[model samples]
Target chain A: MADEEKEQQKQGEMEELPVILQLRPVPAITPVEEQFLKKFRFLKAWESSMPTELFLTTYAQSVRVLLCHGGTPVTADTIRCLPSLQCVIATSAGLNHIDLTECRKRDIAIANAGDCYSENGADYAIGLLLDVLRQFSASDRYVRQGLWPVKGAYPLGSKLGGKQVGIVGLGHIGSEVAKRLVAFGCSISYNSRKKKPSVAFPFYSDVRDLAANSDALILCCGLTKETYHIINRDVLLALGEKGVIINIGRGAIIDEKELIQCLMQGEIGGAGLDVFENEPDVPKELLAMDNVVLSPHKAVLTPEAIVSLQDLLMANLEAFFSNKPLVSEVKDE
Target chain B: MADEEKEQQKQGEMEELPVILQLRPVPAITPVEEQFLKKFRFLKAWESSMPTELFLTTYAQSVRVLLCHGGTPVTADTIRCLPSLQCVIATSAGLNHIDLTECRKRDIAIANAGDCYSENGADYAIGLLLDVLRQFSASDRYVRQGLWPVKGAYPLGSKLGGKQVGIVGLGHIGSEVAKRLVAFGCSISYNSRKKKPSVAFPFYSDVRDLAANSDALILCCGLTKETYHIINRDVLLALGEKGVIINIGRGAIIDEKELIQCLMQGEIGGAGLDVFENEPDVPKELLAMDNVVLSPHKAVLTPEAIVSLQDLLMANLEAFFSNKPLVSEVKDE
Candidate 1:
């Protein structure tokens, strides 16, 4: 009787094996992670497109888990079609592209690599700050063009010391930026969901209030329904004339039209942006402005951050399969 | 017989007046300083060219003070001609253009406005630091030339944090550079004539040792017999591959040809130079290299610093006439 029951248990387990679909291409993994993934025999990984019909047909008999990176937004139709889909893992901090509400209704587990790129983001933010404050880019241009006259007027740049640096979100990236700015002799203040008792910086309840008080405002918040176009014309105007705005957050957090307008009007002194509302295609108006500094959204693409991400993701997978608690589990409420 | 004696005494007093010859031109002074100069009625303050004959004629009138700014260099012949010239006030630094030993033999007091430009020199040093570390000028070239691609690969730049900064001179400008670098989180080390007890930074006994240990070596010592060509090709080679050199000190303190060669060979990573061996004309070959950053010798010509220098000079003049000590008196020895 015990042998018959064991046979039935083995059959039940064989029927419950999950299938994995990788929608986006990732860079090649390191040798250690490749060996780790080899132990998951019950799972089948497919590098397939993420369309509804394709994913449904591809993983018909098994519970599906889709791994995705950045690109086009995922819709409710795409989520609903994956009948056996049990989880969705976004290998990025931002989840605006995914249909979170649909996944919630379907009782799907959702997890994101939120804090992986925090340090890289902060490093790039500081780089931009130094670039502008030191007038490095402008001076280089002067010499390269051979336009530097023997007795020409020197650029009178101001020191970064004694400047008010306002952080819009006190999340991982924001906190890191604050820490680095502190070293530069800047006074820090922030606006977050709630005042964190652990942090010593002054907290502002409103974003405009933070901007009004700061000599430079940095946007490091998430993009959500409430925060979409949060940094609008009013906020930019409130920042006043010697103010600089640095946006490393999601592009949707800022109103692109409003930012370009303010920059053109000189309502704000300057801007250093690494992301735009519709990236890979920045607004022509913003591109024309001399007061703005632009960088492609490669701030978080550092090799160090990428390696850390792969390691963390693989560890999470290992823990999940071993019936142990997952490292970064998402609640299904 | 008493009236005759009084008349004789008055004549003797008249004969004691010392003639003053003003060479070149000076800016108009404030009423306060002008009044102070009036008390020195023994000084003639006549404006004249420093031709050999004119200088001799002026010196023949028992001129005790010679106020000179610019023209030809003063030679031994000119100094001998000015036998009655008891003092020479150069309105600039660098007595290399003046015959110092000749003036010493004639027992003439030689004074200069050397310390007047100290603050300006310091400010320039900070400017060079900012330019090189931040890569401002290079980025500007890419931006202006419209060569900025969506993801252009510029050299990876490092912040000033966790780096040892070695100052070749701990004089006015080096001290100021130290103060400014403190904000950037750099560890300051310096080499000077003697260890400065008041300063908190570590002092190195040898410049080559300092260069070997430093991520950046700043030249801020004055050019003198003791310091001439102090930073030679050997020191540049000692600085190694990761090192940066910034020279705001006298250009003679560095061997320009060797420095250019070292920079070309990548013996040192880069250089930020404001002063070169030749005034108004920097080496065209050095300018062609991407590794070197160059600026004209106008670092100290900021409007604020220039105004401060003028104010200090006027204060010194006032003090000198009032039988008070000069603000920045140079010792003959």
Candidate 2:
């Protein structure tokens, strides 16, 4: 009778453990994630030798939480497959890849990395701006190529102080970018969906108007239906020659083809870009341009930022299982 | 009799006009110098086909002011050549190019570019720091080299937030660097000759102590006898493996030879150097290292800064001729 009672209790304890579903492994983004996976167990769909469809159908019947990130698209099809899935946890600040419409329609709770990537994103955006205005990498190449004496005097770069900088989105990343730029004596104005009452910076309802007033334009908004190709030829023309554009937001937010054309025609001064429309495939024309600084979509990647992302993911998962609200939940618009 | 009197008055007016002796053409530094030369005439020694010594001996004998910059050194011999030289007007901020001891011994009033270049110098210093820590230039190289897709994922950079930065000199440039870093959420400390009562940041009189506690060291101090080679092998050792060094001051402040050796041995992480121990001659080893960023000692050269320098130089000359206190005069140490 004692043995039978012990067996029944063991089975009940196994049922109590919450299962988290992952389409792919988390270690793809950060190396520190593997050890943390042991602490917070995730049922990785990719790990199974069985077909992903078969595994999802068999194992995710009672799964309530799905863990994903900006790289992995959690589509309507995937969400519909998991009948019991009520929550989605993303490990990135940007939610463009998460199929927001599907999440909203199903009433599934969503949590993102929140402000974990804000500081790093802001640091990088400003870094790119400085690199472009200062011609840092171009000059570094000149020095490394032993052209100093031959060149006589390096070209004087445009000054950063007292420049009018326009920030797009003015969300976590944009706001943080503003903080750093103010210290450099830059005046900031921003554009967003709606004017924020708490913000003191001048607001421009139209992106083109912001470009007209700015010496530089820094993109920090998310990719959305309205925001896609938000920065087109009209905006570039408004920014004008000697107007620098730094993009840390998604690439499609700008019209890539038009931006290249503007740069080729010398309509815009320069650009500092982290994200591209089709990443890993940068325009060949920009590769030789000294004014343009290109980075491989690494603005939000940092060692400390990864740690913060992990903490945020753990916090969201714990809260959901405990029958509490997510820490940084994205509400339906 | 009337023509003779008119000639006498014209001679008196020509004598009243101040003569400025230049060892070389100021136009070599800035193109604006050529236009300003006609307004405030400078006797260019290089313009004469005659030997510089012969030109100085003949024309500079009665010249009361000398115009020089960092590139054209006003050595003890050069100062000795001009017996009537009462003032030295430097277009550059740092007066290390001019022999300070010789000037002081001869009782010659010296006026440097004052705070004209401070904003730009600070902008460059912080820009170098951000570039070094955030790997802005290195990543740009990767993207430009078409290695993004081939590399899969670029390496992560260190975060700027909460980093402990040590300023070697708390002059105008260092103060600006601190202000910018604070906005990025970094803690700052400094090592100067004496701690200012007004500054809230922790100060270390001994630079070695500062190196032990800091993640980065920025050299913004003037190149003095005591400050020369301030950052040596011992100091680099204390800064440890991950420490970064940015020099916007004179190149001699850090032992470039030892810095290269440390960087090679992985004893220190990286360096962002604008001024090298020798001009136009950076260590060959640093040219290949990804962590090292080299510039051609043009940190203080900016479009707006050149304008400011001309204004400062003009004001100092006017004040000196009027028997008023020389503006931005460097006090004798």
Per-residue CA lDDT of candidate 1, range A194-276, in tens?
89999989999999999999988888887878789999999999998778888877898999899888888899888877777
Per-model clash counts, in order, read 5, 0
List of clashing residue pairs for candidate 2: none
Compute the TM-score of each model's chain A versus the native chain A and list the values: 0.85, 0.93
Across A121-167, the per-residue lDDT of candidate 2 in tens digits comes to: 99999989989998899999898888997877788898999999999
Cα misplacement distance, residue B51 of candidate 1 (Å):
6.3
TM-score to true structure, per model: 0.68, 0.95
**Superposed Cα deviation of residue B194, candidate 2 (Å):** 1.7
Q: Which 10-residue window of candidate 1 chain B scores lowest in summed lDDT?
A: B24-33
Highest-lDDT candidate: 2
Residue A287 in model 2: lDDT: 95
- Of all native A–B interface contacts, model 2 reproduces a fraction of 0.84
Share of real interface contacts recovered by each model?
Answer: 0.12, 0.84
Q: Which 10 consecutive positions of candidate 2 chain A have the poorest summed lDDT?
A: A28-37
